[model samples]
Target: MTSLRFTSRTTSDGVVERDFTVGEVPGVLWSPAAGPDHAPVVLMGHGGGLHKKTPAQRARAVDTVTRWGFHVVAIDAPGHGERPLSAEDEQVRDEFKQAMKTGDIERFRKVSVGYALSLAERAVPEWQRTLDAVQELPEIGTEAPIGYGGGISLGTAIGIPLVAADSRISAAIFGGGFFAYEEELAAARHITVPVLFLLPWDDQYVDRQDGLELFDAFASKEKTLHANPGDHRTIRWHGVDDGFLARHLG
Candidate 1:
């Protein structure tokens, strides 16, 4: 069991942000400056090329802490952000660049799906270990309810497996930005928790039907599909239940 070591802390706008490491995985946790113990914890995942604390992600984390009094934590995925890239990471990055440069859509999908699969394999256990360490904190004991605060692209790719493998997460939010393979669908089948699946109705690189199909794969009896027009980058989520997590996890 890896223990989280807090390395730094900062506070602003009624939110407290702390940087910590569990073994080699670097993570950031945001909480209300003065909050009750055993608050619901939300695990937020960053997109493919982004680190855990991107401006947008940080904003969301702060909002979650402020509005819902939920602690939000995000970690640098394997070979991403503060973590050094391994040989496989470098190779896949090169492949992605070459495929995009040469306008090879098939090659792009192939390499990206393979890389997403590899990253998810490494990330699931990292998240479980993170939960283990996080639960040890006095403020957030083992009784804290947990949820995955999802994102599009690589975030969803890795999150699906984590939620499937970890029973602690009682509800999850996922989005579509990457190509879905059979394994992802299989994992989805195991997730009995309530899910909110977001889909960009007009993703240029990924077919819209793929998102629909992936949404269908979820075994959650209570799942909502929220589709917004535009690609993943330009999406403006509206009309969806902002209270979804609060309703389920509260």
Candidate 2:
């Protein structure tokens, strides 16, 4: 696999930031330049505890999505970057981290699910911000089939925290986002949209079976799940079997 080199060229070169409003919650947008008018809009987030746009995902935004004629936007989730994690949230996270470090997988799962759900409930501002992030795209307003999505681990974990009722994202692709089955089914009961999911075997981040179980809930006929070899990060960059990606994304 080739390691990506960041130059003052295409990848980060196309990057630009702007602010937009979603209801009352304001959000910042990072739009990377794609060739021209692409149909479905793809939104992205960096891994948890990271900035909005990590180099790897950002590189994929340009190399994979932008090159494929899909407009890409990556944003820092609430409490990430300039956003501040609440004191309660920080304490919870610290305690949760201790549990995980102790190799208590069951406890980790339980705490994570509860934490994520609580976070989502408390994320009224973040939801509005997500809506605003899309509304304030570089291309601005354009009625189109929106593809809301993200990557492995927390980046693309589940669409629950990222989506609001007003969101019009039609086609979403979750690449290696290890979705928890019960959590996804719970959050996606009302979500009726075409979603595309790619899960990798041996991915330690998110459970594979769980991801598939979640994907199965999509009422839309267009939703699908693909399981293959390669770790979480590899399937993302190194020769992403984009053969299926191009068709679904378009």
Candidate 3:
């Protein structure tokens, strides 16, 4: 099992942010400046083309730490953020850009799906290893409950598989923005933990029915679907049961 190596630390607004690495994977942990040991931990995933600490993600992480008093952790996905992008990753990205420039929707979908799956394949184990390191910390020992605090799109794509494979995760929050691939649906089928699925009623690239289908695929007997009218970027989440994770984790 790999251990976390603290690389930097900063504090603001009663939240302490620590940058760390689990072997080669760079990640950030946000926690309340003052909190009990073994508090619940939420593993947050960023959207496609975004890094671990984007403004939106940081705000959400801070809220999770301050509002729920739970620790929040996020990591750079493969070839994203501070991680070095491989030549193959660069080529796939170039193909993706060309497809978008040429108005090739099918090519764009194909390229995006392939790239997302590849990233997810590398990320799931990275997350598990990260969990292993996080549990070793005295403040968030092995007994701390875990939840997937989703970022939609690429986040949901990777999180579906992570929650399915890791029994340590007690609950999850997922949203729709990216295409729902078959493998994602398959992964959702294995998840029996409580779930909250957020759907953008209208998305520019992904079909709304696909999101519905992905929600339907979840085997969780306790699952809720919340929909709002807008695309992923413009959607405002309202009336969500923010206590869902706290209830399950505690």
TM-score, structure 1 vs. true = 0.98
Pick by lDDT: 1 or 3, better one: 3
Q: For residue 135, give model 1's deviation from the true position in Å.
A: 0.3
Give me the displacement of residue 64 in model 2, in angstroms.
5.3
TM-scores for the candidates:
0.98, 0.73, 0.97
Q: What is the lDDT of residue 155 in candidate 1?
A: 92
For residues 133-195, what per-residue lDDT tens digits would candidate 3 score against the true structure? 999999899999999988889999899999999999999999988888899999999999999
Q: Summarize candidate 1's per-residue lDDT along 41-155 as a digit string, tens digits.
A: 9999999999999999999999899999999999999998999999989999999999999989999999999999999999999999999999999999988899998899899
- State the C-alpha lDDT per candidate: 0.93, 0.57, 0.94
Ranking by TM-score: 1, 3, 2
Best of the two (1, 2) by TM-score = 1
lDDT of 2 at 155: 59
lDDT preference between candidates 2 and 3, better one: 3
Worst 10 residues of 3 by lDDT: 201-210
What RMSD does model 1 have? 0.9
lDDT of 2 at 168: 64
What's the residue-level lDDT of 77 in candidate 2? Answer: 58
